[model samples]
Target chain A: MNKKIGKHTVRLESKPRIISVTSVVGPKEGEGNLKDYFDIILRDDLNGKESFEKAESDMMYTAVLESIKKARLTEEQIDFLLAGDLLNQLTSSSFAARGMNIPFLGLYGACSTMTESLGVAAMIMDGGFANYVVAATSSHFAAAERQFRYPLEFGNQRPPTAQWTVTGAGAMVLGKEGNYPYITHVTIGKVKDYGINDPNNMGAAMAPAAVSTIYQHFNDTKRTPNYYDLIVTGDLGKYGKEITEKLLKEYGYNIRENYIDCGEEIFDCETQGTNAGGSGCGCSAVVYTGYIYKNMLSGKFKRVLLISTGALLSTTSSLQGESIPGIAHAVSIEYGKIGEKK
Target chain B: MNKKIGKHTVRLESKPRIISVTSVVGPKEGEGNLKDYFDIILRDDLNGKESFEKAESDMMYTAVLESIKKARLTEEQIDFLLAGDLLNQLTSSSFAARGMNIPFLGLYGACSTMTESLGVAAMIMDGGFANYVVAATSSHFAAAERQFRYPLEFGNQRPPTAQWTVTGAGAMVLGKEGNYPYITHVTIGKVKDYGINDPNNMGAAMAPAAVSTIYQHFNDTKRTPNYYDLIVTGDLGKYGKEITEKLLKEYGYNIRENYIDCGEEIFDCETQGTNAGGSGCGCSAVVYTGYIYKNMLSGKFKRVLLISTGALLSTTSSLQGESIPGIAHAVSIEYGKIGEKK
Candidate 1:
């Protein structure tokens, strides 16, 4: 039998200890809409240099604030801020954080930032760095399109495998000795070139990296597919997920029984038709923080392994004919006791 | 007696446990000029959209790669990527990593990203999550200028207290049982408002958060200012440093003797003439990875405390006339040997 050493402390039972997800926030409705490169329509009221800047910043801030609220933490009580966004100078995150001024550490891992940030945050708390830590990320279609593709109103058509950039943010707060399942293990992906030369086909490029990291994660911890209630990848589209499954099978692991890809799962709308699926920092973020966290809170699943995969390539390098490489990081987040007051 | 365990390990006789930084990489000798945002000089060679996108992506990739090289780690060996950047979709980091194909976790902390990433990475190694981890961040001038200040060609003048946006990247690698330092304690800053209302004066506004975190760090660790070689804050500029000093004195700790603020110290160049100093996410990153890390490797500093501060205000709130609040997170990095290498 398990025992409580203190108010929030948990003494492990005969079963292995599990980390829990206490709260999650972001995404107001079903799989958010994806804005095309030139499809972002901003009102004149929100126009100008500072306008869009603030919008992006505000989105990130709200995500984190909402998550903290769900966790019942004030800015003062939160131990750390782990946040990032898809902006050139990280203006949204930096600026959003400007007023909430709390102890913070910024990070960037592209589309996989949320899980990366959460992984590290959990480790810190588990290692006794602090009690509460928050992780957040944001992505705006206007800002991202302007940087990576055609600006708004440019009328560009995306490729078949191209993913809809998510214009949103997501956040979660983690604490040590909480009733939530503790973060168990993390797996870091390695940069690998499998000769997929197209930067646009990021899904295909990143699939293998995802497989390798996930495989290694299981290997390192001696865990099997049955160990987790759910296994999810960050934002690998349908194609990537398909290939990832095949690759995992090659390593003698079958994940289809309990696997879900955040990208494919979150943007599972017909008219929404997010090509391969939602692909952005916010894709996995919103899915996990909003949808997944809500489910966990309701006891839909108890143990989960979130592997956020990312394609780490640049347009310049793609233009330079460099083959795209990919990486992914895996973190285990679980739910603990049910209906606990915040 | 002292003995060498292997190429990866070092031991000392009854010496205090210390964590040392081995190397760093980023914009050590240059600055990004926001004024050039509208020059359109590179327009002929590349479209505006593509140019900015490439700039954002390249900067992110450059910082991570360079930091890894500086740390002398190969792409295959790194346990994980702990990174964050400001972008709408986290495109730069995702795209960059897609090409590198390294296992990674994306993170965000606005401008405080690097330190946050590092803090988590360090803790993971300390907690036996992984042996090696990398933390990185990047920012670009043109893209940021357009997003945060003005359109590319607006040519708006920045305030004197405003810091120059860094158009570069920074990266660092942490390893357990390496010759470098073991990250000790970490203190997360809280959002506190002394009611500084000016957006232009972010340096001053964020100073209090920095002071609070640093003071708390010393208190938690029960260490005095004279305990180590240096105490560094991530991006507090000249103005912020002065304020931090005053606040520290009130707490009865004198850090002025060995205190170093990354923003002020890094952009202290006469030519740079950065009024207060660097404020972008890359500021503290480049300083820590480049200047501080090199100094530590050369034995110039034995122990250091790196406090990365951030103002958690969105551009919208600032435009809405909301007061800016700030927070800070600190990681104690010490050099030398601790116990035995695994």
Candidate 2:
């Protein structure tokens, strides 16, 4: 008995529970601040694969299996797998699903895929359509660069505004109901374009979208930022996080104190040599499923608003002189049983 | 309330009604077998756009507005829009969704996008999470050719097994419940790769997926193919359709008498100079929304199973020596009333 709240938000009455989760990342991410949270840390980017693309898919496959095992369930018991990645035609997810034999639904929300997959998984569970399903997403540094920018052989210098693409994957096992963190609501975002065209400055392009969804979520849920312990944005690096904060303030919300961008949280920008911070589909996914999940389970956090932002653009669109459009989907995860806010 | 049937099928209790639909096609498709069924046919492929990609996006935008207007709905009244396209990062869908403020969920199922969108839309509506939502998909011939194969100006010779990409879009408005045709069941498919590596022979690559899903649907529902007035494979073309028929027969189900492939139905292959048939996200979309919708409204096709098959590979994946993985999603649309399958 879920209800559509206002325009973009849906109040999930069933509050599907997170059964288990797994995070797999490459060596670079293994050295990040949330390193201890990951379940699998590859020694190198290739992870025994011939190419980065294959490695990215294998990372997700590992996450899927690890998460199911963590939840004490077999592949046959899982009803569906909702996954996506920042690759052309969703090759990363497609290849990963091919070996699993689970019913698959391919999703594409650019980097906002983490929440996009989670939102769909939660809704399907809340709807009583399935007892169990998995929501997962992944991205690789080398794979994304080749697909979205110049080839690796070109050795072009990245602009200062550019954020490092996280080489990682995250998977979450969601059940109909459990004592784990409850996904109580989801706010789907619209494509918001501020006419930012530079592909290197995705944070700038996606900032407005992150703000818009967060603001809409606040209004629709009839709650302020203080209602939750934290309000996190996916891959909006330090600069983009600043923009989002200012934008939200203009909309009558001041979330400055309780906000943290996953891009900034994942890496120490200055020491790590990552121009801005970590950013990609995996940036928010690993942070949420690994760091956030662990914190929530340990009662270190109560309620959290996770808004995964994405820049909706392909190299072709950029070449065709189209401005980058951004979108963000927000999911409210509260620790406790159903009807328990804290 | 929905019931999970057997392994992969869902029996939707609400039976969300199809409120309205629209189909848009280009000049080439307009001259095809189902010419009269299209809602809007462009005089040329460009449709006044600067490029085929933009034209494809605009065509879908037209379908979105046309379907909404046909249902007497304003964009504001629409709760969500689920859309996808056979473009990188879903550029066509993302751009089309940008102009509309409706909250969007981007899907990527290659050619299977049409049914993927419909299945999610139906579930959300049946769950009472959305009062009205739209499911849409699209593809463009020139755009696809340049992206997937050679440049349009390359003048590459087409192989006999090659299918022409369709220049079209299809959109449908789904509501909570009404007297319209009911969406009662959906069988989400797994990725099936039979190691078909030839990019030109997508029919062979996707046929196994089509058959696997259809056979699974029949088995899970405990019903034979005769229960439906028509059973359509999205765009498996002539050869794929034959393979699907032969494969289903081995599974103890015969659907030859009432079976048709959208790819085969969309164009007169021999006359149109299309080697295999029409195959793209738009192929099944236009065929279903244009041809099937008209026939159903005219008291034909009472019960139908629409399985949209997708070849889940990108040019990058192919170049990286990967085989084409395929997935098919099946949805059951029954006419007249909820309890009346006939």
Candidate 3:
């Protein structure tokens, strides 16, 4: 009856099943390691839009529509659309919401928005407030590059610590009950900052928060690392992943055996020349909705934990000599009936 | 058991109560119409901070702490802190969350965040998921000026249609049971864009969406305008308030008698020179938490509907020749016992 477990985790009595999912990406993402996992790939980055910002919105719009279609439901049947993006004021999500015609609640969890949104939608269904809800998020490489750093037209050098912002979007329709992968628990995160200010090194900034949520999820759920088939962090990239592994170990949790970061898994960093790896709201979104969700449906993964990490820093904050605050939310989605354990 | 009503309204049978609320504002807002209602007024806009961004975060942080104190709850007792602001990447909120050490979920409904968050927290309590939750939002004039338009130091001329962003923050603690103003229903909105691109004319851009949600709320709940003692829109400003009045009449609902705009109520436009009026996440926030919430406690208002409206547009999107989108969410807060209707 009481959904609050321990401290921050919510144990959903009614596991909200993700009915259908869709992932859309730019051509560059289509050339990545898991290229075949995506549902739609744009012809180019611009996707015929006048600006990269519109293209980002169009990508999310396509994913939302395709996701609803994949669920075999019309727009009229859906109760709510919960979405957010990395863009300023969340233009991408709002623009996409315009066409959906569902009750919309825009969220902003930075890159961690994917899991944060899922957690909210899961609570809505588990609480028996809504029948069906769509949770989605997005980001664009050129858009982020321009908004966060230099303009795309202005060529600039990047540090190896920097991660490429994925030009993609992903959407999933979650229902009250179904035979699909069900979301069972959600551990909302705390904003943590270790005084890292460099925008180029977001992984370093976000890694602490990723570990904080992941640790709390385990502590509250009373589940060890072995309980999950895989524990995936949002976008900690390569360097942050290493930092997370070490920090998590100090907390007496050794997850290196089954741990993977979406940022690192999205691209073959060596061949793709993606510096550290992929990062953005789209990175974890596409990886989970595209790769992880597909694999779960195939029974390749029975129990999985997704921790979407975010660096809560604006250009203004960094310019004002403020540190990057980080946050990460973990949601548990499992397939096959759990026999009280894995 | 079904909490959702006919369309977008969520009928909270348990009626989560607002235990306590706090409002903090800058010097300019402190000199406005609702001056005496605010809990804390900063001596200066900077509030001894190095930048406007830090001051914004501090204002929200103060409101959060004070609200918790007023509720007689410690940071540890609060289950989740749901907050957002108009700043890019939601830095103000995330930074505030850093010190609280509570589970955090950042929202981005633009200015509508105040209601969007309350709706989420209400559902969480109604669902018996959490015992207590906090919903907060803030915005700063200097921060908005630099981020959305020209820097304050640049001294750019503003159009008469442009509304001044309010420099304030407000927070409220919601609990499952309490003897305070109870939240009864929530109507989530849809993003509506009528192809308005002028950033200076956000009132024009947001008015339709405010009316859209208001009409939907009344229709879904089968409640006439007379059901509410007061009906309020977030920050539609003087001009947008007129638009809403005209549009709602077309919907066959005459709410003009009791309808008031927070943007208009917060400032004496004639004396304050706040162009159209005060507008920001803080405009509706401080007005409601400081003035409206207090009135409800004193039984001056029996039933009130707060529709926090938001204009969803980023500078980049506008620069890209995109139109401004609007979204508004309505939350029903009432004092004393409701005998089915006011």
- TM-score to native of every candidate shown: 0.69, 0.99, 0.98
Tens-digit lDDT track of model 3 for B1-342? 688898898899988999999999999999999999999999999999998999999999999999999999999999999999999999999899999878999998888999999889899888877899999999999999989999988988878889999999999999877578999899999999999999999999999999999999999999999999999999988899999999999989999899999998998888988989989999889999999999998989989999999999988888878889999999999888655555
Ranking by lDDT: 2, 3, 1
Model 1 has a DockQ score of 0.23
DockQ, per model, reads 0.23, 0.85, 0.87
Specify the highest-DockQ model's number: 3
Estimate, for each residue in A1-342, the C-alpha lDDT of model 3 and write its tens digit.
688998999998888999999999988889998898999989899999888888999999999999999999988888999999999999999988887789899888899999999999999988778999999999999999989999977889888999999999999999866689999899999999999988999999999999999999999999999989999999999999999999999999999999999999989999988999999999999999999999998989999999999999988888888899999999999998744455
- Output the lDDT of residue B59, model 1: 60
List residue ranges in candidate 3 displaced over 4 A.
A338-341, B338-341
lDDT of 2 by residue, B283-303 (tens): 889999999988888888898
The candidates score, on chain A by TM-score, as follows: 0.83, 0.98, 0.98
Clashing pairs in 2: none
Tell me how far the alpha carbon of residue B166 in candidate 2 is from the true structure, in angstroms, after superposition. Answer: 0.6
Q: State residue A306's C-alpha deviation in candidate 2, in Å.
A: 0.4
